[model samples]
Target: MTVLALGLNHGSAPLDLRGRFAVPLDALGERVQGLRQHLARAQPEVAILSTCNRTEVYVGLPALGASACPRHAMELAEPAIEWLAAQGGTAPAELRHHSYLRAGADAARHAFRVAAGLDSMVLGEPQILGQMKAAVREADSAGALGTTLHQMFQRSFAVAKEVRSRTEIGSHAVSLAAAAVRLAQQLFDDLPRRRVLFVGAGDMIDLVATHFAAQKPLQMTVANRSTERGRLLAERLGAAQLPLAELGQVLGQFDIVISCTASSLPLIGLGAVERALKARKRHPMLMLDLAVPRDIEPEVARLPDVYLYTVDDLAQQVQANGERRQAAVAHAEAIVSAGVKSFSQWLDQRASVPLILALQRQTETWRQAELAKARRALARGRDVDAVMDTLATALTRKLMHGALSELHGSAGEAHQQWADSLQRLFLRDTA
Candidate 1:
């Protein structure tokens, strides 16, 4: 089956479109199962990798001839788009402009680069690799991963590691949390006086909390679904913990709310933010939603006192660090290219497995027939040693027969090329 990848990401789509395409982490397994069932009717294998930065579908299908694989993929995408739109309160048409579709080697390379964080808003950020790995693991557990998709993801991870180790792609990296801190600095002159409420105990939340804590916010609290994980992170930062249940009532207590959670639905909607704003007497509140499916509702952005930012909005704020990482880009790109070539070669070789098996079967059949004839000769009271020698000679001659016939039949350039190749493959020379 040929491998193909399709999807949209931060670079190809705006926040609205990305929000429309985001898949909830909780529903990912069911989504993958649905995709598998849908694609299995025609396409044999499929895997999905969805993150805050991108939503990609990788499929393994029969040869492109008269196949509806692309159409099937679009059909599969429709439900995902509809689901995302319902979550974001947007229409599919409105989100289409922001979507991108990639196929073949380009798709493979894109996956690798994404895992390496080259395509991230904050270039060379490391979180995306882990996120992608988690997605792959989920897909595998859901039985969405087949040979082609499995190989692609495995090689993509390898490429990411190679790029990270061989180049400075991840060196001097500015994470999304760090970028959020920079943005908050632009809004507030002094973070020390500001109350920061982190709504989630995930890694992103932890990292952002650490950055905000370094600034020594006047007060900090971690509100999470599980108070235990929240308290763990809160204690590390000398912050307090609150149940997510208290978020609506206590939202007004913080000047900043940075949330990153695996919640499938929005935790902070427009009404909650509006109430919080009113409670705060219209004080400006900086809100960052780093979750893929989104922790904050898009409508919350319309609130006068709520300055909301999604993952895409932060991309513009992350500078390329162009000159400092220019040398690293070439080195990283070379590593990715080599990785892609090697992966492609392996994929091509994999496609020839059936033919290789057929050839092996054919050779074994001939060997077995010759062995039977040798056994009969020995049974007829012929010398055992002679029978063994005859069997060995017959196998060798049978193995070379096709090559000798081809060499004799070949003409001109073909004959010379075959002779040269044969010499290189088998000949030994003495001084």
Candidate 2:
């Protein structure tokens, strides 16, 4: 089977389109299993990496033959695309229009780039690496991962570590959390005087809350559906914990709000923000929605007193820093290039495995037949030297029979080709 990467990322699709394809982290294993079932005819081996900026499906499709080229494997991408489109409830044509497909070496290069953070919306961001590792774990647990995919991802991780250690790609990296803090600073005079509310206790929220906490915000609170999870994060930052049910009742107390959660629907609605504005006497608020489907409603952007920004907005804000590190990016790309070359070489070697096994089996059979003849001769009390000579002759003819037959049967150019191939295979000193 040939390895393929099929999906869309922030670079290829808009946020709304990406959000439609986002699979919840908690259900990743189940989704991976579903994909395997969908492509069972191809006996697919699969792994999926879904993040805020991308949702990619990496798979291995059954080959038409041992020599099947990547282009042929690419023709099988329709099934995977159909399965992925089904996930978002979109038509196949629409998903295909926005998605990309990479086969063979190109697919390997893409995997390496993603693991190294070169493909992230936030260049050199470290979060994607962790997320990729999580995807690998989920795929393995779902029984969808196989040798081809496992090798690709394991190599991807090693290459990512090499890129991180050898280059300054991650130096002074501007993460989404940092960008949110920077944007909030532009809106408020002093963070220390602004009340902050974090809507969820997920990893994104924990990171953002830590950044905002470092700014020493006046009062910080974490609102989550799970009291234990929310309280743990709150305690870590020396903040108060509030039940998510009370979020609407106390929304007006915070001047700066940053929210990220797994909710399918908007957590902060227009009416809720309208009430918060009235309660605060129309005090301006800065809200950043880091969630995919969006924790804050789109209508909140229409409110004149609120500054609402989504992941797409943060993507633009982080581009300046990414552009400034072109040198490091170039260095990292070199690492990825070398890694892709090595992985392709490994794949080529693996392709010869079947022929190598067959050759071994044939030679072993001949050896056993000769040994049986030699043993029978010895049992008849024949001379040892004569038996050894006969055994050696039998093995030699058996080994050369195929080549000699080809040399005698072919003519003209075919004869020369067989002679040259045999020389390379059997004549140690042929030049």
Candidate 3:
């Protein structure tokens, strides 16, 4: 079957729509298994790559015996899209408007570019590779990874390594954490005097904590859903820790609030921010929500003294300073192009595999038929030497009969077509 990738990402869909499809790390394995079982009979091999920015399903379809060629893969695109929509409980029509359907060589190139961070919101961001690896591992565990998908990801990882090592694509990389720190500087002249509160004990918070901590803010606090998790990160940064329940109680104590939680709803509403702004005597506060669904309400941005930046909002800031990395875009694109060509050649070999097997089987059938005749002749008291000669002659005729029949019995265009095919089949060795 051909390899295909179908999904929506931050570039293809909005943050709200992407969040609806985002699969948590803990839920990825089960979701993969569900899809595997769902398509087990018609399409057995599949893998899923789900992240904060994207959720894509990669599948291998039987392309030899059935309507499963590269073009057939395009037809199967709707089914794959339907499958993803089923998983996320979304309308297929809605997702279709903002999704990518790439098959065969195109799919390989997409995977390589994504793993290399070329397709990320933040160019050359390294987090996507890890997310991809995790998705593949889950698919493998679910017994859904087959030769096609397995090879695609392995080659993708290799391409990513080559791009990262050979080019300076990441030289101007701007992470969300770094972007938040830079933005905070705009509001507060002296970072050392500003108080920063990071809500959530996850990777985003840890990253934000590290960068802001480097500024040695006057006070830094990590409030997480779990106090224990928050305490560990806070200790590393020499900051205080608090439970997530206290986020509102102490909201006024910090000048800058950055949050990224796994919650499905807003953590801080407009009312809470309004109260915090009033407590500080209308003092302006900068808040960044790195979460997908958003850890803070959108209405907070309307407040006079509160600045609310969502993930997409921060992405703009990251891209604004990404011009330095533009010089290496051509170099990286060249590497990706070479990588896609190599992958396409490999896919070509795979496509010819069925024909090679059919030819070998056909030859074996002819050999067996001749050998059986020779054995029967020897059993009937024929001369062994003569029987051997008869066998060899019969074998050669049997092998060439089908080709000769098609070549001679045909006329006009058909005759020339068969002759050309036979010429290649029999004369390639001599040439």
Candidate 4:
């Protein structure tokens, strides 16, 4: 089977399209299971990696003839794309412009580069690697990871580590969490006096909390579906914890709210925010929705006193440190290129497994035949010891026959020179 990757990411698609393809964290396993079942009918292995920034499908399909490869790849990718679009309430054409399909070495290289954060909107963002790992884990739990995807992801992780160690890609890169904090600071001059409410206890929320906590806000609160999880994070930050149920009532109490939850639907609607705004007497509230599917409804942006920012809204702020990191891009690209070549070589070696196995089988067959013939000769008792010696010599000569012929047949300058040396050592003695 060949390696293939089909995905949509922040670079190619806007938040709306990306949101359509976002899979909730809780439902990821089930969604992957369904995808695997569908692909299993046509192909053997399939894995999915869905995050706030990207959603990718990696598959292993039989190597069809040249004329059929494209057709087969498109066929496999079509259903997946349709399924994703359906989830996002979009038409296939709506996503086509933003979708990318990569195969073979390109697919492998892209996966590696993505995990290394070279492909992110914000270069060297570390969150993507963890998100990719989480996707792989979900795919594995869904029984979707097979030899091809497993190797691809493993090499991806290795390349990411190599890039991180060898390059300054992440040196001055501003994290999304930090960028969010920076954006919030621009909206509010004094972060220390502003009340901050973080909704969700996931990694993104934790990161945002960490960055916000550094400012030592007037009041900090964590609201999550799981009250215990919220409390855990809140206690760590010396903040307060509130259940999701209490969010609406207490929403107005905070000046800033940073939310990133795995909800498939919008958790905070325009009406809710408007109500909160009215309660605050139209006081400006800075809201950053880091969730892919968006915890806050887009309409909330229209509210006068509500400043809502989606993942895309933060893109401009994230580019602030881009010029500083430009010098390191070349070094990072070099690292990625070298890593890609190594991964491609490994993939090529993997392709030769069947050929190597076939050669071994042929050698084993020849050995068994020679051994059986020797057994018969010894049974005849003409001379058992002589026959055993003959058998040993015959096997040795048979093994060398192909190598000796190739050495004599060599014509190329480099090949002929090596062949001449081998011939002098082995054939010269025989002659």
Worst 10 residues of 3 by lDDT: 62-71
Q: Which of the two, 1 or 2, has more lDDT?
A: 2
Ranking of all predicted structures according to lDDT, beginning with the best and ending with the worst:
2, 3, 4, 1
lDDT of 2 by residue, 288-369 (tens): 9998877898989999999999988997998865444888889999999999988887776777788899999999999999
Ranking by TM-score: 2, 3, 4, 1
Runs in model 2 deviating more than 4 A are 64-70, 321-323, 407-420
Model 1 TM: 0.81
- Winner by TM-score: 2
Estimate the Cα RMSD of every predicted model relative to the unseen true structure: 4.7, 2.2, 2.5, 4.4
Model 2 scores worst on lDDT over the 10 consecutive residues at 62-71
- How close to the true structure is residue 227 of candidate 3, measured as C-alpha lDDT? 76
Model 1 lDDT tens row, 359-386? 8998999899988999899889999999
lDDT of model 3, residue 364: 94
Q: Clashing pairs in model 1?
A: none
What lDDT does each candidate get?
0.78, 0.89, 0.84, 0.82
lDDT of 3 at 270: 89
